[model samples]
Target: MTRELDLVVVGSLNVDLTAAVRRHPQPGETVSATALSTSAGGKGANQAVAAARLGARTALVGRVGADAHGEDLLTALRADGVETAHTLRDESESTGTALISVASSGENSIIVSAAANARLSPDDIARARPLLASARVVSVVLEVPVETVCAAARAALESGARLALNLSPVVDLPAEVLAAADPLIVNEHEAREILQRNGSQLPDGEVAHAEALRAIGARSAVVTFGARGSAVAEPGRAERVPGVPTEAVDTTGAGDAFAAAVAWRLSRGDSLPEAARWATRVGARSVQHPGAQPSYPTLQQVLDEPGLPV
Candidate 1:
């Protein structure tokens, strides 16, 4: 019998190669980088690690290549206390990789090589059925194949687990999967793009974008504005959750931290607004440091941070 878990993440795992540059170059231009770093990352892995460190019993369902990067990613996930029994190894492809460039202003741009991640099929979701059944919340990110994401959504629905869909790098998805999102999470740009993709009138403001998502198909929705907070919309209510003011040293994994925190808190029975509030703080804290998984703050860390005011 699989034990109950707070969250199960069905997404991609990648090794992130990051470069620090003074500024991002314009197209056809190149800039010299000051430093380079390699880290255990990928939207799925980062969210799973953040959830685990925040005291949730989290499990990851994804595929990694049979390579050194894969080994390192698995080691990092385990060290962070995320269950990886379902993280499979594929021998055909190298691990997924993200080439990221962070500028002095703390903004970043990334290019992804979806190698092994592209190999995660619906069959993988079928194999992880039991783990999905034992989860209170199933969080799905879009770094993997869309078919696999759809399969995970169906499994979450069948298991009666709440679905938290983070629509980053947004793409067209079936309506049923869109409707399954208990709280569809998106950044400001993603929100607008998703709305536009669905043939809805483009919302003029960020808060309206959140409301429009709920109107389309999502049970509820959240549109995040970095450093300014997020807007949340549920069945009958809409609210803005303010952001935590902090100096950002790197903004890389802040959204992943936010998504993880919201999913974890929702599993603990927080309301949409309540969860978004917690997520905002977690995201704010993440940008204060460098890297993705490494920058996440534990629940106690959030509670103890001075001037956060809870």
Candidate 2:
């Protein structure tokens, strides 16, 4: 049976090993952790779950190891309402894992081991072309190989679906890929990298980041500035969309949530500004919880929150 999808995410999936510590340790120094946990995470998996919980018909395309972690990760994704038929199992490598340490201030440091995630190839994407063709929007992150991402993007484009790219871990994208994406999501640091690589001056303020993004060929851009909020820009207009007020517990997966919400809203035919507002609220909600996928809110939670100006 084939199900129509509102959004399809082509990327990585991993088990997250998290420890809450007093502070990040300096080089050659060790810090004691106050709490510890393990959960499912990965930019792609996080976003796919976020979208699915928010009532989007979401499908995930990636690879997982034939290990215990992989089994648990797939179960969690299914529980979150994400379609996992396209997720491949690799016996050659273990499931990917992320080692994360969160400080009391909500800041975090992370190291990722892309085991099975790195094994996702263009052929895998090609096999999922039918699902990609049925989606209203297709989202991709940089965690997967650039070639595979490009293949997915091209497939989405050919299918007349909107292509959304999260320029995470901040890498320079080829001009062709950038042109194919409808809206590119990035943070302040990523904006700086894009501007620097293009030999363009940095935007003076948060709003300027949008213009900088447009100058680089993005049809539209959203630059998130954490507590300060986010900026949304198209060719001629740009504005700061304020974030919802919330006490952050852990900042992990906040950006992925924001990106997912934006794509979901846009898939529903909302204006860019309206979608940015939804994304901002979703991001704020994610920070109030601890783990990545576990912290993400369902659509009802967002709709029921009185703080959001629906």
Candidate 3:
């Protein structure tokens, strides 16, 4: 019997400590915050939560420390109905954390302390092999060791699952691994970094960037253009999908939310552009609230969104 999981996110886990500020502090200057809060975050955990909330059978494969913070993170994942069987607790390091500053304009800056997340070794990936193999889409990010991500991509390919790789934090990847990705997901800036680093001229626009990304390796590519929407590119095709309007309070996990939506929809057999359309709506929904997981919408909510295509 083949066990089927919609998505399995393998990457970092972090506890986000965020502060509300009128504006970001200058390099040598200090700024006062209006409020502060703590939330469960991490590329892996956030993506899995977004998929699970949208009615996907999702799981998280990653590491957290055996601290109280880790316990809270585990609780939060379980609360979101994400399978945590593959999530491990490392007693050696403390839980990962991110220091975040949210500006009034909905933009945010973050500093991450990888802590236990950095300790997600190849062995951890070996242990999660079964879960990875069972998933229809294996979502990977660069928060953990790059080697682990490459290994997961290999596993996804071997298991006949699609690899949805998000090259955030903009690290160089081996061409083989890049080629294995079914859809390489990146924001406009990350796409530029990847393209320019490979001696390819940066594209002038979102759809062009997506096309450039596919040229390097990925079977398809999606480049996010913030509130303007996203562009999808594959062999001989590139198109734009406009973004949905929403009252955005925080943009913290918008990208992760978009990735999650894309992964879930792709796992269910939607085409890349269709998946990105749904992802745009999900990303828009994510910004309407204050935190990452807190802002995620349920499948019904997205389905009921105004102006959804019939």
TM-score of 1: 0.97
Candidate 3 lDDT at 193 equals: 88
> After best superposition, candidate 2 residue 26: deviation in angstroms?
1.0
- Candidate 2 per-residue lDDT, tens place, 1-310, comes to 2337899999999999999998999999999999999999999999999999999999999999999999999999899889999998998999999999999999899999999999899999999999999899999999988889889988988888999999887776778888876788998988898888888989698888887888878888889999878998886678999877889999999999999999999899987788999999999989999989989999899888777867
After superposition, the stretches of candidate 1 with alpha carbons farther than 4 Å from their true spots are 1-3, 307-310
**Cα RMSD (Å) between model 2 and the true structure?**
1.6
> Whole-model Cα lDDT per candidate?
0.92, 0.91, 0.91
**lDDT per residue (tens digit) for residues 1-310 in model 3:** 2748989999889999999999999999999999999999999899999999999999998999999999999999999899999889998999999999999999999999999989888878887888888988999999999988888888888888889999998998889999987799999889888988999999687788898898888899999989999999977778999988777899999999999999999999998999999999999988989988888999999888888754
| Residues 1-310 of candidate 1: C-alpha lDDT, one tens digit per residue | 3439999999989999999999999999989999999999999999999999999999999989999999999999999889999998899999999999999999999999999999999998999999999999999999999999999999999999999999888999999999999999999989879978888987777678889999999999999999989999998899888888899999998999999999999999989888998888888889999988879998898887765534
Instruction: Flag the better candidate by TM-score, 2 or 3.
Output: 3
Clash pairs (backbone) in predicted model 3? none
Provide the TM-score for each candidate, comma-separated: 0.97, 0.97, 0.98
Q: Pick the candidate with the highest lDDT.
A: 1
Report the Cα lDDT for candidate 2. Answer: 0.91
Name the lDDT value of residue 266 in candidate 2: 89
Backbone clashes, candidate 2 = 0
Between candidates 1 and 2, name the one with more favorable lDDT: 1
Give candidate 1's error at residue 82 in angstroms. Answer: 0.7
